[model samples]
Target: MVRTAISRVILGVSIFAWVLLLINPGHIMSMEHCHVSDSGPSVSSLHMLLEMNPIASQLTGWGLMVVAMMFPKLIIPIQHIYARSLRRTRFSASLLFAFGYMAVWMAVGLLMIGVIMGLHLLMPGSYLPVTGLAVIAIIWQFSPVKQRCLNRGHNHLILATFGWAVYRDALLFGVIHGIWCVGAGWALMLLPMLLPSGHTFAMLVVTFIMLSEHLEHPKVPRWHVDFRAKLFRMIVAQIQIRLKEAQE
Candidate 1:
């Protein structure tokens, strides 16, 4: 009981740190870029958008990362476990993973910022992602393979408080995450690359939305999950049969 209490305290501190870094990334950047000016949009305009943002982007991203890192290699099943409750382990994992994942994305963001900044300097104009991000979002969400993977994970998770009916748990989750992530993100990263240049704010906004959606509940219905499960089972059965045939 005492050990559990200590773990919870540590986890709370870690989550607090993750939330702090996420909410104040600009402030940290400002310390380094102290000489920056009012060259961009006014504070009022930004404030209006900020007001409309219901989900705190940084917090959500950090929270999801915490969950991701908590289980390490396993993704959705743990996430499935994490999302539906106030489980303390999930909280701890979310907090720790946030810092680690932020370290990774911060580095990636820096590289992207430099590249885009260079383009802004050279071109002095132009931007992207504002117009086309939604289209790419729709396609990835509806893609056949991604839908298949999500269905499999969802079906398995619905009753999985302890273990899945399957033998290999980690492998199963990894496969689900690979497909889900492809559906959920990768293309969102391409938004920056796709945009004309100097649309850093736009890219960031889109990325934040993408990150939030990945962590949130699926847009579809619970009843919508059945078709995909059957398909996955059939595919697995077919593979098993082929393997047996080769042996014979």
Candidate 2:
């Protein structure tokens, strides 16, 4: 347990540091550019310190998110065991499935970075990472899509299956967790992909939207219950149509 906690802390710190670096790469690049100068050498500002590197930022942020969302690995091993108990599956299979699920999101994260980078390249600047990440974060914070993500984080889970061992509850929990993550982070992840404007406005906007959800009454918020339902229904319908086509 101590080891796991230590690892979590390390992972969290590593991610936070990397993200900060990406957001301030210029600051890190020239430590002497700490601040404005009065006939003296300039210095890097706190902002530049945080925006040290974009690749590092993306990796750290996504890694931290996946780790946090994937805590069932240690917190609820029984769920995995339970899922296995229902079908007498091996431990290795559970690991494989859980990893496969994670792989899906990793791909999603990478796709987001790819899209963001493409947009950033077009902008062409020395401070691309800072502006790009901030913009993405802002959009995700305020957008209607961000509201759905915030709601999912705020809501509780629903268990669909039954009859699993106490030790195997991890698998069951894992299944639910897997679904929740993809549902919650899908559009947010797509922010990097979908948007062409490489600025932090999107990030700030999304942040405000999410912050509103946490409030008792959030006026001017992007999403409500209906928004989620509408998107979900559309998604379901699209999937059903595709399935029908395949079956036909």
Highest lDDT model number: 2
lDDT of 1 by residue, 1-248 (tens): 54455446545654565455445454321111111212443455344333432224433443443332222223444454356434544444433333443444444444544443333333323444324554765566456554443444344333223333222332343444444443445445545443554334544454445443444434343223222233345568999999999999
List the candidates' TM-scores in order.
0.34, 0.35
Residue lDDT tens for model 2, 87-118 = 44434434544554566567666776555444
CA RMSD of all predictions: 15.7, 15.5
Distance from true location, Cα of 102 in model 2, Å:
1.5
Q: What's the lDDT for residue 148 in model 1?
A: 48
**Clash counts for all predictions:** 3, 50
Candidate 1 backbone collisions, by pair: 66-93, 66-94, 67-94
Q: Candidate 1 — which residues are off by over 4 angstroms?
A: 1-18, 25-76, 79-125, 152-179, 188-248
TM-score, predicted candidate 1 vs. hidden true structure? 0.34
- Quote the lDDT for 145 in model 2: 65
